[model samples]
Target: MAGSHGGSLKSWLAVIVILAGFTVGGVALCFGPNWPLVWAGAGIIAVGGVIALLVDIFSDVIVDAPRVLASEKVDRKG
Candidate 1:
């Protein structure tokens, strides 16, 4: 239950890798027009995607049942 809402560590790592790639690409654009670094960033993002697939991150996701609020329950009773 502690980690029910959060995904696995591996999935988190994959997301971090992808975010790092975005940061790299952003830095490249901010400083001069560094096409090579942009490409490198794209590669990093691709690697992250591959890692996510390899770890089967989708399988770790789950749909939780919708909670019934107390107010809603009272309204239904009336």
Candidate 2:
């Protein structure tokens, strides 16, 4: 039976990124004076959250690799 996590290492990395974005965004919203930086952090958090959500939902489809057949190999005459 296939386990829950069918995504690649990159997907996991994305999750990490999302967490970091949320953390940074929260901190910026709490402490940053400038509105632009706050908005940028919020945007980053939103984008990262969406990507992580998609990755988790479609992990299998996202990470599935095509099977290669031995007969598909081309032999070089060199």
Candidate 3:
């Protein structure tokens, strides 16, 4: 059961969110108090977004069409 830390990931996520909020909150509380770490958060979010965009773009290569059998249809009049 050493590696079976069930729900630990959820707990860690909760802690990270809380800490992030507090960090921005503290920045606002000590600084102008209006735009507390907003820029920093936006920048971090943008970085992740850019990576996702690049990955998605790179994976979207042109796909080939499926082959159809010759007997499927025929133009007898032609």
TM-scores of the models, in the order given: 0.80, 0.46, 0.35
Candidate 1 residue pairs in backbone clash: none
Error of 1 at 66 (Å): 2.1
What is the per-residue lDDT of model 3 for residues 20-66, given as tens digits with 9 covering 90 to 100?
65666567667775663766655554554554454453443444556
Q: Give lDDT: candidate 1, residue 63.
A: 57
Tens digits of per-residue lDDT, candidate 2, 1-78, equal 133334576576666776777777677778856667667777777787787777673544443356676777678998
Model 2: pairs clashing at backbone N, Cα or C within 3 Å: none
Q: How should the candidates be ordered by TM-score, best one leading?
A: 1, 2, 3
Error of 3 at 8 (Å): 0.9
Which numbered prediction scores highest in lDDT against the true structure? 1
Instruction: Pick the TM-score winner.
Output: 1
Write down the lDDT of every candidate, Cα atoms only.
Answer: 0.87, 0.67, 0.53
Worst 10 residues of 1 by lDDT: 69-78
Candidate achieving higher lDDT, 1 or 2: 1
Model 1 root mean square deviation, Cα atoms:
4.2
Task: Quote model 3's TM-score.
Answer: 0.35
